[model samples]
Target: LMDVARLNGPPEAWHLGFMLGPRINAGGRIGRADLGVRLLLESDVSEAARIAAELDRLNSERRIIEQHAEAQAEAEALASLGLEDKGAVIVTASEGWHPGVVGLVASRLKEKFARPAFAIALEPGGIGTGSGRSIPGVDLGKAVRHAVEQGLLIKGGGHAMAAGVTLRKERLAEFRAYLESALAADVAEARHVNEILIDGAISARAATPELVATLNRAGPFGSGNPEPIVALPSHQLVDADEVGQAHLKLRFKSGDGATVNAIAFRSVGQKLGNALVQHRGQVLHVAGTLTVDRYQGVERVQLRVLDVAVPDHGPAMIR
Candidate 1:
């Protein structure tokens, strides 16, 4: 029921996952997971919705907290091992960092670097809990699982992509050492943030009603399954305008002369929007997902712009 409902709802699986599971996790991360679980398992829809909203708010707050911790982790990582350490990741903790949220940080690190990441948060009781994250090629969850099997960790279990554990405060150094040795040969990737692998390029002509239906066949893409992104050649700008507080609206004409609608959400002050605005008559590379925007009761196909690059021919000079 949840799966079918999610398929019909908002597209981000992670956010949806949070909707079902992590709302309860918010309590656990901050106060008590048991409370979060109880609110959902025991409450009616209205009560549950209130709890979920609180949890969502908490997650947003968690982001602010993690931002500081991430900076500290990156600094510590750079200071101790330098910026080039590709084989290992760091999971340090301070008095203020919460154990429940450490794993999220670890997951962020893993996603940011495309390498194994460990994040531990120091608890007031002199204990620490941690989370680890990994990508496809590197078996990060398994690496941590190996330590759990060897009894190095107090308790641990999770999926292949992410895992969690508990440990005594003093075991921090040993844990890092154990993880380092466990991943001795698996550190083969470079120190670069991995970009989303583009499925293939497409022509504006391919953006059609029938094609959109075909693409929907590959639906329910989230987490494991990703939405397809199609790249097109530079298009002529019909008009460009800003919307909301931080969105850019673009009217583009395909090579075949069909006009297309594009939106750069949350891109008002970014390089991509600037390039699009400045190069009104020029060309720019655009990457984004196919979305249907319902406006005034009509549905229109719009590109949810993700990335833009300066054309090889460079920006056009306009006075």
Candidate 2:
């Protein structure tokens, strides 16, 4: 493997380590990621798609659970003694919150405030467990490693932006103090508001089938590897309608006069969706995930609406 990687790059090859391989993790925490492993090892596209859909459905369910935990975490953070002042936050509950969802909640909090965050839902007894998430330029996993080295934490591991740990449940207070001490004055005073990072202006003509294919090389995107966000000057909002209770589906006529359908999921009171619906014929900057959508036998690219802010304004990110 080193030789193969070296051929592609250099002779001083370094083997990347994955603490918890994703497929193994999916099985340990969730039910079955073996399906994905099998799909990958074999050239089974249809079966792979079917299995992947189940995984996506599982993730969707996980998202719902995460949202609930996040609401509680926000309140907990606010109530903590001078927690907001610390620049980093750790929210803990003695075994009531779902262990699986703590990491998700941490991620939400991090996104909501643009701070390093950790969420713990460990048993109050002997062995406790937790997961964490972090912001850009901060490595929660390394923080956990340092804490463990100092005997402040027990068993913990993760990549740059996320981590999981196990320790004495009684040590929650100790852990909190340690993290505060470790992170204090480590970060600058840059206020982080979640904003979509756009990849400059792209015309509908640039969004060709071939371009979409080429752009997809920068994918298998998740966590750190994110899909690029493309912004248009303004597409004519030919028709807009509400769908799925709160969602807004809009059909846009691009500069090439081509029709592109975009859907803003869960955007009722949401700023972008509401703005588009409230003011028809208004040009707004839309930030969204671009994807190829296939219905029946037809294939087309569509934007998975992310945020909409007034044009000439900064990008919009859902906090």
Candidate 3:
């Protein structure tokens, strides 16, 4: 899997870290414990190819599972927020969810709502295995251990950013309540101080292939280090359409008359998609990371949109 023939340039760290990384992780995530390492070790060309293909299939299945769980978790999170004005953490559990993918789902929910989230998978015997992802400054691990000490969780431990828990299904509600009370102050502080950092403001014309290449040097972005978010200020939405099931493809134009392309993945049915589709010909500030998109031997800079706001609305903040 060292081939970069189809890639625009030599593979950057992200290609190996994200694209291939998930395939390797699928083994652990999906219960095929040895599949990932086996793929890396198989020397026979045909055998390695087969393993790679199977891993790819598993990764795709993982995405589908994560997507479904995320949808359910997001819905629950939003509904819970409606009931409590200061909802700090979203704890969702259900029977039959693949326990392996719950952590991924929690990550997606945390990203969407800017809150600490936990997804629990319940087994037949009233036992649950849960994974959680937390926002900065919230000690998810400490809280989990505290829950164990308080007898709210059967067994649990983790760090500030992530955690794992095993508890009786009956204790789920108690654990949730414990976390809400334990993390209330920290979550509130995190939300109030959380701000999207913009690295720079550039015209659509300035978001070029060269710029994308330069940014890749600083990446392989994940957890603590993230890809930079830049603003395309005052760009008017020109063409907007949904592509690949739920990704919203967009074209924006600056006053100087240059056009740039963007896509908000899995956004077709969300607020961002609805706003963009309705914003034809309207000027807005868009923020996201830039990537070099290669298709059919063509390479171009495209923005993976994260957030957008009216020109007068100021920088996007999550609060």
Candidate 4:
């Protein structure tokens, strides 16, 4: 599978999550539920390759399906929340949505809105299956269990960060109300404290593959152990363009004539993408984590951008 994807180098947490994990999960999401397991347990190399190819195809299909559903869900959320977006949770339901992709839609909503969100796929008989994703400090699992006990949900359970549900379409309003009331305080607190914690500052010249490897000795970064975020102060945005699936690809140049490639995933149509495009050629403060991007047997440092700021008048700082 790694060779099929042109993935070379030691597999990191990023590869596991963004590259391999999606293909593995695609079987359950939009294809045969047992395909991933079958592939894993298969001993024949040829059969395994075939299964991997099927999974890759399914994952691609899943992306197309997810993109359509996500657009609809976003529209529903906007209509429900209005321009103010004054809501603790976003609940979007549609009869046309596929159950397999609701979780992906929910996750996108959560990221775009900065709050807990649910996307439900309503069946012909008014039954719905939904998935939800929550922001930090909002205990969605606890609230789901409470709703189950209250008969608002047919069945639902998960951890603090994510969950799944079954319900009657008739009860969606009640379920939404319950979540908003129950989680409002917690969500408020979480968003209030949600600020990027920068570890240090560096320049394009200093952000080398060697430095990234040394920093990554801290071991796999994930939910509990997040990748460190560093800032590049007063770097000029050399170029910016919208790339695959609404991602913003960027190039930044430091004062000393060093350049780095960066990408803001799923930032197009968002505030951050707009800012970067609008301010092209202007100096700004960029913050993100560095990763080694290997392509065609060559490895280079790439930034997974998190946030950006307009620099206040000052001397450029490189550390």
Best-performing candidate as measured by TM-score: 4
Measured against the true structure, the TM-scores of the candidates, in listed sequence, are 0.62, 0.64, 0.71, 0.77
| Two-way lDDT contest, 2 vs 3, winner | 3
lDDT of 2 by residue, 1-319 (tens): 2112211111132121111123234442445647556645767778777766666566555556666767778877766736445546554555566677777677666655556777877664667777887765666788889878878778887877788888887777888887777665443432453456787667655655566787789888876787887876577666667653455666666667776666665566655666777656666666676666443455566666676666555444323
lDDT of each: 0.65, 0.63, 0.82, 0.85
Q: Model 3, stretches more than 4 Å misplaced?
A: 1-84, 111-113, 136-142, 145-161, 296-298, 314-319
For model 3, residues 1-319, the per-residue Cα lDDT tens digits are 2122222233362255447867888878988979999988999999999999999999999888888877787777888888555588999988878999998888777867778999999999999998999997788989999899999888999888999999999988899999899999999998887766899999988989898889889988866687888998899999887654566778889999998888776677667787888787899888888877665577777787887887676666212
**Candidate order by TM-score, highest to lowest?**
4, 3, 2, 1
lDDT of 1 by residue, 1-319 (tens): 2222121123443234335554555666776566666665855888877777777788667667777887777666666566665446555656677666677678656645546777887788877787888765556667677777776788887766678878778888888898777765555543333344456666666666567667879988764677888765676766678754455777667778786677765455455667778778666666677765443455556766666655675533111
Cα displacement (Å) at residue 37, model 3: 9.9
* Candidate 2 ranges beyond 4 A from true positions: 1-71, 81-86, 124-126, 181-197, 219-226, 236-256, 263-281, 312-319
TM-score of decoy 3: 0.71
- At residue 99, give the lDDT of candidate 3: 92
Q: Which of the two candidates, 1 or 2, achieves a greater TM-score against the reference?
A: 2
The TM-score of predicted model 4 comes to 0.77
